[model samples]
Target chain A: MNRSAFPPLNLRWLMPLLLALPLLVQAADPLPSWNDGPSKKAIESFVSAVTSEGSKDFVQPAERIAVFDNDGTLWSEQPMYFQVLFAFAEVKRLAPQHPEWKEQQPFKAVLEGDQKTLAASGMDGIIKIVGATHTGLSNEAFIDNAEAWLAKAVHPKSQKPFTEMVYQPMLELLAYLRANGFKTYIVSGGDVTFMRAFAEEVYGIPPEQVIGTTFVTQFQNQDGKLSILRTPKLAHNDDGPGKPESIDSIIGRRPIFAFGNSDGDLQMLQWTAAGSGKRFTGLVHHTDAKREWAYDRESKVGKLDKALDQAKAEGWTVVDMAAEWRQVFPFATATSGQ
Target chain B: MNRSAFPPLNLRWLMPLLLALPLLVQAADPLPSWNDGPSKKAIESFVSAVTSEGSKDFVQPAERIAVFDNDGTLWSEQPMYFQVLFAFAEVKRLAPQHPEWKEQQPFKAVLEGDQKTLAASGMDGIIKIVGATHTGLSNEAFIDNAEAWLAKAVHPKSQKPFTEMVYQPMLELLAYLRANGFKTYIVSGGDVTFMRAFAEEVYGIPPEQVIGTTFVTQFQNQDGKLSILRTPKLAHNDDGPGKPESIDSIIGRRPIFAFGNSDGDLQMLQWTAAGSGKRFTGLVHHTDAKREWAYDRESKVGKLDKALDQAKAEGWTVVDMAAEWRQVFPFATATSGQ
Candidate 1:
């Protein structure tokens, strides 16, 4: 137990090689893309509090659970949900069957490449498009379709593949949590199975830890084979208060810490607050319009008004994107349509 | 990292003092009550595999995720589901306000303490009883009511509290897993929050790692005050393939190891087998009819048909409860139960 939990054999020399592989993944100076300020201090403090067993705020490894909202919080959930863009490409490929879609409002707008009309359709229009595109498939089938799209699809702004649009600093945050013994979960408004498609490759959070909205599914025995049929019934919505509910349903305990962006995340933060004992509730504010699009009270996507007002009062740390993140997406990536 | 994660630095010699404290727990050795044979082998193989880093089956501290089923898997789920027992008690307590319950079949049976009528009514009848018992309550209300029932409720056979009905071998299994860098999770069909109420005391597993069925909830804000509400909604069912689905939806990885007893757990065992490289799935077969119940295939409670068949086919380890477990429940303070 003292050394490597293994005997001091030459296999020990092999152990350092295994550990070195991950260290090589990090730059010589870790967190090179982090903005220098209290924002950095805040992140450092939270990590230290949960990691330092000797400190007053020390938490046991078993109790260290940290949850994050995907989409805007992880990558750019701007212009449109990246998954929506994936759905659009899928719709075009499947367009041969749906001749009627050529005349439909959102579908016609999307097919005609009119981003304005598609935007005008709003959340209602988006839901209809996603449901139509994602339903009528097995869980495996849906995952394959999403993964295929990610393999080819590029972001509108970052020009990189949607997976590359992931925030570099947030990636650092995820690794930091893992290094500190925290189990991380991706609780998002995105489709559960859809996120599961590439969440492992992108976030290092496995399919099992991705909690999101689900289409209704039915277990069926077909020709002595077991299969579950997928339908467009709203199963679980991992949004707002549903975040905490889903956490309870899946993880079964109130998270010691939570992070999110927008009013859609307000309920989750509040539910986290009701939990007794030392807790942390942090919100990611998308306020870098220069580097990244910024909108709060007036934005349709990832609206952060109610959460902003409560952040200061609740003493929840609000990370200012422009001031906190030295970089958004990885430098290896380039802007969209570049 | 070699030293204890928790140290008595400021209070010197505190570790020695703490170690000297009499452990309140009983049956650290799981041989006295466990029946014997394969059940013992299953336990042994699991501990040996995880602890042996050179065995090629060795699991790293970070990758060690172990899942266990509740009810029949951890404790006896006979007569009826244990959670149902709790629900039945709560239903009766609230019966004075619901006059219609007297006219209902299961409720009428439950209220009158007529075990015969309740048993005769069957699954449909049981569902009716559960719905009547579990709904119309807040999350806090449900948890408080459950804890109250647990405090007073006793097993008819043991005459001790139901909490004491936990398998002593399983407690040792949990501690052993943690000792080998594994995080143990109780994925049960029982109410999610309900299990968490006493899991820390009963199982070494903390509340956070427990996953199960859930109710819908709402976050309500009154002026500046906020609270969450619980509603009757099917969240996730941690049974059958649902066990694997829940594991995927919550844990974020395919556990390298799993344990369960009934046919209800066959899919979970299969899921564990599909894990990459090093994997183990242990099935606890209840063969000790003298001490417990021995019915497997035909027994409505804890039916083990699919799992027994699969264990043979897949070369999975099948543990015989009567022969393998040296002890079952913990003894009262002394080496024997009162």
Candidate 2:
């Protein structure tokens, strides 16, 4: 074969084009689950501004921190938070060990499945249940218990795994932001250990990236083995103003973008907006009674009255689930059909 | 161009080899400042075991967490911790505004440059100095004050900038671990804000990776501007057992490798060592009195007594500084002939 008969295939120029083609093909719609609306437009434009080099709003990759509220923002919080359900289940599971719980009000209510009595018991009762169930175990043991429960547990209303109840549009948004160099974080009211179990798998957020309400932990050396023991005391709540406090303490940088669903996230939104740059503050307004639960403002769980007003006044993106989302859960097709 | 007279370049076969050649050449000794010794050999072998695929001790890249103690382990902590020096400088800088500080014991001692009286003031006086200087300012202001002091602050004996006092061998080790897919973190007895000020520039560890002692801070909305206000109240003292506690709280994973120089880091080392599989724990023994301060059990600052005993008993790698390190500070040549 004469070498002169063959045309030179320039591998240097051709290889890069070949490699980049697949990426271009894969990067079709970053927010496919999102319906074309003001909510999606706002998100897209904000990301574009921050990521584009030479743009006035461009933020360095290191400074592109994006925080999210977990309970209502990322996943459904209807019928009450999923972690509370886990706590109630835990109380029932440990009932056999605690015979005294058969007499105690909240524990008895939990064991007997008396929802009315448990609801009537209020914050004190919830704290008592959390303190009992969430403490005294090694952190590894607690994580194991939470993971085991999450493995099989189903959401009562949706008849799906709790992890499956994550908002598809929001999931798309998280991916979109991350694709644009934003570091996604879960700044939630959920306990750190509990959220850490599912966050990594479900949301692609790592354990270190999840900041949440924390309980005091002690280092225990049992013989040669070591364990972190969870104490009953609450170290940080990570709700309301506590969100920004924990964000500053843990991340040591203010996020340029924040998303939330209730009054608990108001301070976080306010804090993010106060940064001197082109920032994005968004709220997930529960406005679809059909696909998902729609109660907000007057609802006991994930109340959005003050924050809703602020969102409207500040021109922040308020995601109208009914109109803005083409899909609800990851398991369901567009509109969920259920 | 006469095609019959030319030969094919075979670029396809040539490109990859050309790209890989530089990498091969650049991957020289990972720790250049580390002398050929038991300590360096132990580190190299442990890294090889964990990073090698199919090795029984191999760790996944995400799980390769390495924690380091900042004060005596990474840099010189004597004549005293650099942060304490900054605090003393802050007192002097702010003394003119506080007329009452002239009569205060610790403040008067600081202002008068009375080392004996200041040393006599002990921890309580030190706390008073820290409370006055480290808190009541916004986190930004506190960091600004710290950075300003660090920029000009020089070690008394070494007469080098405090940041330059970081151990060259340790810096090389940190970079080496990071190169092999390990995430480096500073779990130090120093305050998080204080350490974060220089961690990224000095040790290549980011702010989020620096876990340390923290004072309580409040999220303040001053009109439209937001700031995290440092409060005087002690939130968590990240020393002794607190080291492991904070590591678990922030990182949410057990470190496979840890380095320290004092009893304050003993718990962190124990925590890392207790993790299942191949682990590395190290301590820097300050035996180089001519080059650096040498003190162990009897030293008030950077005490190494208990931790030295633990390292010996646990078979942890202890770097005998005088023998193991070819260089101490990055600014100096092989021997720092100060």
Candidate 3:
């Protein structure tokens, strides 16, 4: 076969197209669930600036740390925080073991479905409930309990599994940042172990990257086997000022990007903003009562008054859930909410 | 240009050789600094079993966690723990600002270079010294101070920077483990921030992978700037049992591989060994007196007595440094030690 007989392939024309394949793919909406609004634009602009090779705002891959609050930001936190619901459920689950709980104010209220009495018991009651349900078991056992609870529990309004209630827009954003070489972390106010049960599978954030409230553990060796036993002692609160404290203690670096929706996350956003480089901080405003719950300033769970004000004052992106979210939950169909 | 003219390339014969290329390359010694001995063999076998596909002991990449004690396992801790040495040096450097250090017992002893008095003062004195030099500053300031000290501090015996004192064989082991899909972490009794300053540069372990003793930090906002201020308060004492507790709290998973050289690391090794899989626990026995200091049962710092006996009883890998290490420090040459 002579070389001249074969038609020269016009492959030169395909070179530029092939070279721009990645860019073309990226040109497609990275966050499809995010409506074309300030929230989406702010995210894309921040990510692009940080990822562009020669841009002044470009950050090294290792330093591109982005932290998001688990409750109210990544997932809905209304009808009370999910972790509190888990704790309340635990009181009822363990009520059979503790008959005295039927007489105990908090436990009795939980078992009787009396939210009024439980609310009246206050923070002390909440602490008591957490102590009974979260401690005095091995780490493995506690994780097992949390995993079991999450698998079966559903939101009262949506009737979807707790993990299924994660915001679709936030999930897409998490994936988008990760694809651009950013390490996404959940810096929440929930218990570390509790968030860890569903985080890796649902959000793709690993156990080591999930920083939150922590409890003291003990190294216990029985005969030849060893176990880490959880005790009823608070190690770190991981809320409000505690968020920044844990960030510094555990992550050892100030994150350049932060997302939250409550006053508890104000310090974290402030800390992110106070960094020396171009920083981004955003708050997810609960403004959609039709698709999701919409209580902010007056809501006991995930109150957003201070942080919402700060986001407006600082010109931080405040996501209007009603207008900025094309879809809320992943399970919501176009006919249902989109 | 012609299929038949290529003589079929004899490609069938080359297939076997091509297929075996990876194995041939892997056959090269991954841990070149380790002598052909039981410690090296044990490590190779453990890594092989856990990393080999379809093996009953094979662990998922996400679960392949390895923890190492920093003080004596990765680097030499003779004269005194390097962090303590840094504390003493800090007392001297900050003596001008801390004029009262001249009158305080521990600070005075550190300032005067009075070893006998310092030794007599015991753990209380050490804690006082650590609190004074390590806390009451912002996290960034504390880290800056630590980094500056590490930049200039040298091991008294080797006359090399403290970071240079990291063991060559241990460094090779860390790399080998990482290459085979293991996440390596440093779990030590040293202050987390102090270890973090040089760990990433010297040991290739990042700050997030380091779990150690911690001080309480408070989030402070001055005007519009935010900072994590280090409080003079003990958060967690990461030694012995504290090691396992910190590992559980921070990593949220039990490590499968652990290494240490002192009683402080015993609990960590036990915790790793207790994980339900093919696990590895190692102890670096300080048996070489010429290349490095040698002390076990009677040592004041990094005492290996209890752990040494436990390793023998439990059949954990005990590295006889003088016999097993082909080279000790990276700076050590053939003329110096080989």
* Predicted complex 2: DockQ: 0.51
Per-candidate TM-score against the hidden true structure = 0.81, 0.94, 0.93
**Chain B TM (all candidates):** 0.84, 0.94, 0.93
DockQ for candidate 3, C-alpha atoms: 0.40
What is the descending lDDT order?
2, 3, 1
Interface RMSD values, listed in order for every candidate: 8.4, 3.4, 7.3
Residues B129-199, candidate 3, lDDT per residue (tens digit)? 88988999988898899999988888888889999999999999999999999999998889999988989
| Candidate 3: residue A319 lDDT (0-100) | 88
For B67-168, candidate 2 gives per-residue lDDT tens digits of 999889999999888889999999999998999999989999999999999989999999999999999999999999889988998888888899999999
TM-scores of chain A across candidates: 0.87, 0.94, 0.93
Candidate 2 similarity to native, TM-score: 0.94
What DockQ does each listed candidate score? Answer: 0.27, 0.51, 0.40
Where is the poorest 10-residue window by lDDT in model 3 chain A?
A6-15
Span of ten consecutive residues with least summed lDDT in model 1 chain A: A3-12
How would you order the candidates by TM-score, starting with the best?
Answer: 2, 3, 1
Off by over 4 Å in 1: A1-32, A45-58, A96-105, A219-229, A312-315, A332-338, B1-65, B95-105, B177-183, B270-282, B306-316, B332-338
Candidate 2 off by > 4 Å: A1-16, A19-27, A334-338, B1-16, B19-27, B334-338
- Compared with the true structure, all predictions reach lDDT values of 0.76, 0.90, 0.89
User: On a 0 to 100 scale, what is the lDDT of residue A68 in model 1?
Assistant: 88
**Could you tell me the lDDT of residue B88 within candidate 3?**
89
